[model samples]
Target: MGNVRLRQLVIAAGSLDVADTLADVLGLGEAFLDPGVAEFGLVNRVYGIGDQFLEVVVPTALTAPAGRFLARGGDGGYMAIFQTDDLAGARARADALKFRRVWNIDLPDISASHLHPADVGAAIVSIDEARPAASWRWGGPDWERRAAPGKLTGAVITSAAPEQMAARWGEALGIPAKGGVIRLADATLDFGMGKEERMVKFQVSLPDVGAACIRAARRGLDVVNDEVRIGGVGIVLSG
Candidate 1:
């Protein structure tokens, strides 16, 4: 582990339009699509929220990874990405733990390794290493300048064996499991016990949760108790 931080969360959606709806409810804008990403048989949109990024990937081919994941779990949270200083070292550790690298991207400024979710017994996790660490190429230039109202604070994952899954991810990321949460440099992964394993929610730090709920309502999104469901994942607004 070397200066690891939660960088981005990937949502596999039925279409980019669905992703746009969710982004509207969250007040995230300036969506950027990379044709290079589409060449990989997938279409993607990245929204800037503070220094962090939120991406939605939709498969254009039946054999695409996103499509397969959508088939297994439907439209929902699909991957959690961590920015690390040592991608090679991280891959070595993951290999030792019997984690498989299903996909990768290697470039002059950016590199990544995607671990198989089935082997990790959780959601797909990607170890990313970027040149300046603050700048993400996938999100395009001046991502930080994009209009956004809140910061991503945390993500929620549910598993039947919460403790076991937490411990496993903890060991893999070299992060200590404290209670049900795995603390990262930028955010926390809150593990909750559930009947099945899945990414269930995300926490955003906004000025007013109630006002955010009202905003979502105005966008025609259903809100309850200051939380709304977007593609099987709960968007929880908090101060």
Candidate 2:
């Protein structure tokens, strides 16, 4: 595949209230609501979390793909998108690795291709390419604005063998690693411990760890001391 950039991280929640609550707890900015984009399905809302975007997906009466995911994973982390320069080249790489493409969409100024989770040993992986204009759609006015003092700290990914998982991501993204961390232009991915033979974790960062934790607890969320468990994933808001 051509050069690719790690894009956004997605979390699928069962209810809008839950998603909004979690966003609020994380101090995530306003949400950019999307009425409908997929036929027989709809994306309820989208939020801006710094350079990355968070999509709060709820299935419509017609039962969209998001619904199927909710049925399987319950409610938690869903997918990760890696922005690429060439969609076809990325698909070829995935195909060469025997990864199945679950869906492919070609849109104006943007194209997306997804690979099955079984191949990645995690959730679905998507490669996206778009013109500059498309980026703003995700970071536009409807989303929240936070003046953070630091960049995206990093993401936590739960895996059976942290090293192995890190290697897999390194290979997939064609990026080298350092000290068990895959450094990207915009973020970092850190593999953490797993549970029940399945990886369970979430990406988190904060301007101030202590303050963010206090805010989370005050929101009535089940914050166990400093760490909060969301959909079986251990989350720690770090500065």
Candidate 3:
């Protein structure tokens, strides 16, 4: 079986207006509010950065799954969703590794799966696959267009033991470790920042970080202008 590949990262928020504000400020297109595809919830939105996507999720009383995630995660951080060429094979590997499946959702056009934190030695790790029109498009109003000629920079994963955390990500993602980070063609996943009560940070490449921050701040988001760095790995707020 091949190692799981990092596909997308998610951030949970309290409202869609906030998400829309961030999207508009980022000069992202309309990837957020398209209804032709399945709408998970009113507060749930997504923006396509490149091959990978950044999602902003909001809990709704009507949507049990989103509500549950909000209740469990408490605030926000990096909510990872990995992609695999072979779903059954990946599941088999996870099973062999004794990872417990926490949530499983099978829609008409897509199948989403997740593993428990105990299994991955971190927060929830979700897996998904595109099924025809089931997958949503990346460019649209209220969405950030992929930074032309840009790629995913890196993601920060916090763990008590950085070396062990790196190894676990290596094993799960089927990538090799280099300088405490796993580098992919388009992105890097940094592991082992020490476990603490905080958020996971994802450092995405952008043409203009200052502009992004300005846009995010205008949307009533708590924008922190610190150069991207991870200690306990706090929630990533795209500016």
Candidate 4:
């Protein structure tokens, strides 16, 4: 098996309004509008978050899947993408586990398998591999060094049965979890008990939490210590 890293997390917002809000709060500027995603009746903008990326999709058509997702809540996490050096190995494991992949794409530069959320657990888990190692086509060109206020550090998945979901995810990805926690190269995935299973929160490491909180306050957003809820997700500013 190959080592995997949490490379990107996607949010489904009502519209680009949430993306605009996130750009201000995260100090992120570069946005890649992937034309390919329009086939899904959605508009996608990928922002460079340190070396990783953050993608936000807004449904355009009435029947878009994201539209159904937004109806449940407002805006929230829609998917999680993991970068694996050995995507083939991950796919083989998925087959053994009887995991169903809802979508798949293979290009000259990258290949991705989007697993069915119902089959996996909390959310849509995507395993992808990009050639030339560090090149991320989905994140746009030369985005690795883009400076941002903070970098994503972790994600929290709230599940009815936390340990089981964690184990299920680990099994499908070939990364065994210990007590509902999966450690990656630059971040961690924590599964905690909740009434429902969902991507409830994500962590960002900021150099100046106080300053960021002040900025958020200026925008009339509620900031309780290090966490601020905006763009349909709770951002824990880990200093």
Candidate 5:
């Protein structure tokens, strides 16, 4: 999308232990622990990837939504958030497509709406607009500091009907897919065919994938070729 940017990505795990390993593997420096998420029976930490963010949430209770996702054999790539300049326009498009908002927040600094996963047909999707275009309240203060500046470049979502799912997301975002890839301002979403719908992989643009793979190996992470597994998702390094 011309005006939309890939702002944040989220992962769900069974425990917060993934935080340390992921940080070590990705060279993510400081993390912000948000207490507000406990209200949803979960605990989370947000790591800044430059101005963008990578967050991981683990369920504190068995009945939590993330817990249910894990119970269904899901543990990675929970949500993909995009920052748009016109949230109202996005919501109107979503409404026209019959996509329901499962949760939302409105504040002076930020406004966001999470779409229903069932309707999205893959991973959870959130459309948000941050005031001033660059500020993100969810990533917490001083998130601008980081050890490395790995950018979120793309995400790979698998669905039984990949083309149709991509069409739905593309239409909702006002950026139609080229083939099966929905291109954004800073990232692209690639939809692939799978037995079931889920977010399977994430792509990041880094200075050196070789160095990242070495670090991942030292952390005892599962590194295969140019991809590393953390929090039950494949993090592929490119560029």
Candidate 6:
């Protein structure tokens, strides 16, 4: 099997207005929507943060998956998306492990599989392989140009059974887990034992962390110990 890296992070927002507010607070560029998602009763805004993408989705219908997620966990990190070079190998591994697929898209140019959140023991995990590794259809054509200055380094998942969850993700993705950190080709996943199984924070490196904190403060988000809380998750800043 080839390598895999964290490429996208999806947040489930309580509403469209909250999603928009998050994008603005983070100094993210104007988000673009994928018309294809409307069929799933979801409306989303995708922001390219460096090479990685952050997507915030709200439900159009009360019965939509996004709506159910918001009701269960509120506005927070909903999914972790990984891009791999070997899609078939990944699928085979998942099959061997008997992981259930919640959603899937197989096309000539793109292959995506979303695993059930309950089975993953944290949030939704999405694995995808695009026809040209850099081409992200969900982000549209302008994603690269629209990428902001900051880079998202990794994500933190807090679970009641941290080691077990970490091992599950590590084994499923063929990554190595050490000291609560699962190291990937381009990013890392840190699992922490806590009272909840939720995404707690994301680390971002910017040209000026202080300036970013100031900008966030101006938007009514307080920065405590260089971390800003927004959309029910912490944004940890570093230079």
**Best lDDT goes to which candidate?**
5
- What overall lDDT goes with each candidate model? 0.82, 0.63, 0.57, 0.85, 0.86, 0.83
Q: Rank the candidates by lDDT, best first.
A: 5, 4, 6, 1, 2, 3
lDDT of 6 by residue, 81-105 (tens): 9999987887888888888887889
Error at 130, model 4, angstroms: 1.0
- What is every candidate's alpha-carbon RMSD to the true fold? 1.7, 3.6, 5.2, 1.4, 1.4, 1.4
Q: Which is better, 2 or 6, measured by TM-score?
A: 6
Q: Assess the local accuracy of residue 42 in candidate 4 as a C-alpha lDDT between 0 and 100.
A: 94
lDDT per residue as tens, model 5, 78-143: 889999999999988888889998888999999988898888877778999999888888888777
lDDT of 1 by residue, 1-239 (tens): 88888878888888887787767777787987878877657888888878778888889987887788788778888888888998888888888998888888899989998888887665888889999787788788777788476778889888988878888778678787888789988789988898878888978787567766877788788888778988778888778
> After superposition, which runs of candidate 4 have C-alpha atoms over 4 Å from their true positions?
145-149
Q: How accurate locally is residue 223 in candidate 3, as Cα lDDT from 0 to 100?
A: 63
Candidate 3 residue 15 Cα shift, in angstroms, is: 2.5
Candidate 3: tens digits of C-alpha lDDT, residues 131-237? 54224333344333443322346677777776676665565555667766877645677775654522377666666777666665665555665332221234243
User: In model 5, which runs have C-alpha deviations exceeding 4 angstroms?
Assistant: none
Q: Write down the worst ten-residue block by lDDT for model 6.
A: 18-27
Off by over 4 Å in 2: 1-4, 40-42, 61-64, 133-152, 161-165, 176-181, 192-199, 222-226
- TM-score for predicted model 5 compared with the true structure: 0.95
Order of quality (TM-score): 5, 4, 6, 1, 2, 3
Report the backbone clash tally of model 6: 0
4 or 6, which is superior by lDDT? 4
List where candidate 6 sits over 4 angstroms from the true fold. Answer: none
Estimate the overall C-alpha local distance difference test score of candidate 1: 0.82
How accurate locally is residue 97 in candidate 3, as Cα lDDT from 0 to 100? Answer: 74
Q: Which of 5 and 6 is the better model by lDDT?
A: 5
